[model samples]
Target: MTTIGIDDMALATAHHVVDLADLAAAAGVDPAKYRVGLGQDRFAFPAPDEDVVTMGAAAALPIVERHGAAGIRTLLFATESGVDQSKSAGLFVHGLLGLPPQMRVVELKQACYGGTAALQAAIGIVSRNPSERVLVVASDVARYELDSPGEPTQGAGAVAMLVAADPRLVEIEPVSGLSSAHVDDFWRPNDSSTAVVDGALSMSAYLSALTSAWDDFAAHGGAGIDEIDRFAFHQPFTKMARKALRRLATHTGAALDDVLQEATFAYNRELGNTYAASLYAGIAALLDGDDDLADRRIGLFSYGSGAVGELFTGVVRPGYDRVLRPGAVPDALAARVPLGLAEYRALHAVQHPSDVDLTTPSVTKAPFRFAGLRGRARQYERTA
Candidate 1:
């Protein structure tokens, strides 16, 4: 059987970034509390003309431009920060990419796990139809009430992947370890703009889910505790991922050493939490930080609050280094302009404007951007 996996991948984050130290100063808290305790350097947020749709499109447009839209038959958009309840978010991206009209597009929701769900589904689709290629895009804008416990973790970003046979990047194994249960560790009500979180409860639940998923994976012929060379995890906060690895080591009694790299999550610490795109963005950061990963086994863990968890494995393809675009993440990060506390507060309010007629001249510099709301219908445009 031919192998199937990620062929090409790309990532996009908000155009504006706010330094955590600035936020800490405004809150009258020690900057170290957020920088060290949370292991976050900065938090990302969209510009006035940006959102999940625009960010998602920006990440995916490169793939379509390179691979063309010929064999692409379906698009799976995974997002918790959906702009609409009824329509699929991928449709807007499909239009932006100018893909063929006869295509399948749908939005997935399961908190952060929605991205992993979309990936698994895409792999299954390719198995049934080898000729078809699937576009998987995970995008989100995590929000929290001002000064709330979850506010420091707020972020926005997206990841786009091209999944097909004989991929140039990595080949995903079919097996996965999964754990799901009804839990209210974190939740967002339909009427509210921000999420409600039980911080301590969430941490405890996360540890439990990690061990359960690892055990199931071991039982299902997955790699042993320390067998995989590198690991990528869904990080709501960078420090939580560190907590997970330590817990996994204790659970399996394995001395899983030297599998992590400073580069693996360097960008993530700056991004805070991107919800659905967190794990994939970590993978990009890992690849961006290192080369020489050919034929190396990698472990991936996905978790979503409300909540679902999965542990899967993929092996780096031969000559994977040559195809990867290094410095992409760093380049994007360097391009962003910093937002002052007052500017951030103003933009946050503008994002949730009460008026629907938000039509105005587009000010965003991204390739794709939200062109404000026209009679409650969200409009988008291409700037370049």
Candidate 2:
């Protein structure tokens, strides 16, 4: 067996999440639509200068620095939020992290499912070449203009996972998934800033794709939801995760409500939905909230619209807490500066780069920043 291990995982999100209450009052939306229906209490908004590359680097730094470079041989970045169509975000991150120059690097794109795909691919590559290790990152910003129907769920962030032959985190199991082509949910046409999603239709597709993938996984592992210790779904919204769980509950003889008792509003409630990083964020939340998670088997479901989905499982290893970045989660989230409605709208309206001076001094942002936009490109600089 080609055993794969996850050495460490890290998450980082945009500092600004306009209050849902503020949004509801401004847009005349019932607060429950976001609070109960979507299970979101806060939603992140991307700064004018921030892009996926910077977010990806921020997410991975804590984990990579903790691991200390020795065996990481590849850097795989999965994102839909690329700044340049021609350049790979991995290259930018590799240079920023000062990774060894000899490492293999590539970028993967599949909407939100991009990150998990990178993780799976890295596992396979390392499994075949046991001496080699891979670094996989999934980062993106979900944008839908302020006060739009999709506004309540907007978020930005990234997660980085270092995969090796022997990981200190969860072990990636050989699993199956489904991919389908659909124009039902996506952001296309290079001119638009927001994604157009058929919300109800996308929900159906998530369930449909999960059904197909789980059928294949059941055939291979003979383990169903009843056998797994936890289920982490792509957190597009709190409600969507619950819906997917109910779909899985039907076959695995698990209670949808019971399976998601802790997941409901406890984790992503404040974080909103992070595109590629959503599932990983959920994993982090669960790990932090539960003390008895060791040795538990977790079912991870990831979906991206335009649209693809997967159902996979991993076993939480002993000492998962010790291996993970300590206190990073609470610190990152708490460090954010909450935006007022006007401040959020202004920030969200900041256009993508043009051939202009986008680089500014890092006096306003501490630790992380979009740095500046210049020459139609974004420069992400880390403050010392």
Candidate 3:
């Protein structure tokens, strides 16, 4: 059997921080709406120099180090925050990770579903050419600008998945997916700093996509909503995901019992939404929870815009615990230095220096930093 698995995984985030309580006050909303209602606590605060590339590389480094450079034949970087319009982020990541040269490097986009799409592509490459293994990295810095409705929900982080045959993580199950062209749910204009989202409409669109994907998957003999061992979704926000859950459970009569919605949201609640990294984060949360998922399968629904969606499944591999980050995620979430409103505002106002000298002082000990810009090219340095 052609089995593909995750060899390792990693994650990283910004140093400075914004506590949700203060962010809620600034947005003129209740803190619980985000902290409790949305299931968030902190939103990672990125420096002017760092973006998705740096964060993405940081998350993958720990895993790449564990697996080494020999077997990797493909490097895929998935992100909505593309640093360059023409260039692939994978090239930079390849250099950052010190991988072998004989590999395919590419970048993919499909909203939050980018990483999952990359993962699917990697699986195909491995299944067809058994000698090859693929590295799928997802990273993003979610920013909604100051004072926008999405400001309080913004977050930054990355996750890396090492996919290879006869794997140790989980096997990707075949499932069908559905997509819709909803102009209002989410979008980022060329010149816009903040993403535009129609909250109510986007919530509606997510459920609609879920319905269609579930129907198609079920028709293909895939697991129905009730049969899924765990449901991992894109963490747009606790409230938004909850709305989709209500719709899903109501439609299928299945209850949400995997991870406590509060605890699941807590992971993202403190970190905010990682854009393309959100769904993978959800998967990590479910795996880390106390659910009886052994011999069971997980269903993943990925959605992104400009609009695309996919329903996929994976089985939890034995010894998955050994490869997990092991309290690293929770530790990272807890180590955040909550910033006062004034500090957050000032930090947010700072922009990336035109000629930043990357070899500067270490602002945070998070193992990731923006080294500098060379020939107008951004550089990311991994300290740990």
- Output the number of the lDDT-best candidate: 1
- Residues 1-384 of candidate 3 have per-residue lDDT tens digits of 777766567767776678878877777888777766666777887765467877787788878777777778889999888877788987888887788888889999877878888888888888888777788999887777788667878888888888888777677775656665755688878666568877777766777888777777777888766667666777887666676667667777777655234434556766788878888887777667634556567777787765667777888887777666668888876776667889878877765544554444456665666676676677777767
**Candidate achieving higher TM-score, 1 or 3:** 1
Candidate 2 on 254-286: residue-level lDDT in tens?
Answer: 675655547424547777777788888888777
lDDT at position 377, candidate 1: 79
**lDDT tens string, model 1, 238-353?**
88888888888788887765676556678788787999999998888877777768888888999998779999999988878887887787888888889999988887765455
Worst 10 residues of 3 by lDDT: 257-266
Clashes in each model (backbone N, CA, C under 3 Å)? Answer: 0, 2, 8
Clash pairs, candidate 2, are 358-372, 358-373
Model 2 TM-score on a 0 to 1 scale: 0.93
TM-score, every prediction:
0.97, 0.93, 0.91
Steric clash pairs (candidate 3) = 39-269, 40-269, 41-269, 41-270, 42-270, 111-304, 173-313, 358-371
Best by TM-score: 1
Q: Estimate candidate 1's alpha-carbon lDDT, on a 0 to 1 scale.
A: 0.87
Question: Per the 3 Å backbone cut-off, how many clashing residue pairs does candidate 3 have?
Answer: 8
CA deviation > 4 Å runs, candidate 2: 179-183, 251-256, 261-267, 361-368, 373-377
